[model samples]
Target: MGRKVALGGILTAISIIFLYLAVYLPSAKLTMYFLTGIIPGFILVEMGARQAWLLYFATSMLSFLVLGNLVNAVPYIFIFGIYPLIKYYIEKTRNILIELTLKLLFFNIASLAVYFIWTRVFLINITIAFPIVWLVLGLQFAFLVYDYVFTRVIFYYWDKIRVYWRKDVR
Candidate 1:
């Protein structure tokens, strides 16, 4: 219990740091957010869904407070932060078609929510130089790639990093 709490706190702090980076490094905002998103998966794997969800809430609230901008926290809140849990449950079904369908559906819905919030609520005028459909398609493709990379990272951590930690402790 002590270790779980400590691990959760450490991951939460790391996530806040990533969120801070997103605020200062505009060019790497998405990358930083992506990296932050990866932490929840680690939490979920090491602890459990409950701890991971707690981490998500802690990180989300801290990010908004720390960044002082709701817009900056949008990606983490709307998409990346909660995605690992979503992925875990969806993939547990073990049906590729269902998993793919649900994952893509979640991505599309989350993307739309983010877009609507960014443009409508925030009143940020983003003039896309291309058709909106093209942008959506590109984002869909990018999401698939992101999902693949996310899974690979989880597997790598479980297979390699976690093993090393266990061995060192022994």
Candidate 2:
């Protein structure tokens, strides 16, 4: 209990610091920086540990939009959805590193479609670099390294992640 709280506090502080620096860097918006600040702790909390929902809600309140703007739910979906889906797909199958790679490749295609639709529906200005930038951003946000890193990491814990889907356990 104490350790998780301490870790969460430390992570929150670190996130605030990172958010400050990123905000001042004159690239992404301050809200975007806040979103980055929030993600790591969000991941930690959602691991079925600690005050996950509390931390998530607090982070959302801090990062909330006051004036009307299109929500950047993309970041959240990338973290929770794509990352989990990729992991789940990889963990469920054996000797299928190549297959996992193909799935993620196709996942990127779907993500790009979502990006296009989101921009077309909400964002007034869609830059030419949006797709390219989002793709790179997706790779980072998805927490996926190259095919090599994935093969190595997944091989190590294939059984562990796979347990979540097992009827015997869940």
Q: Which numbered prediction scores highest in TM-score against the true structure? A: 1
Candidate 2 C-alpha lDDT tens digits along 1-170: 77557755665555444444444554765444444534443443234423544444444444333212324433333332234334445656665777666666655775666577577766646556567777667774554543344445444444565456445566
Candidate 1 lDDT for residue 141: 96
lDDT for every model? 0.93, 0.48
Runs in model 2 deviating more than 4 A are: 26-61, 65-77, 80-95, 98-110, 113-122, 129-170
Model 1: per-residue Cα lDDT over 84-154, one tens digit each:
99999999999999999999999999988998999999999979998999998999899999999999999
What TM-score goes with each of the models? Answer: 0.95, 0.42
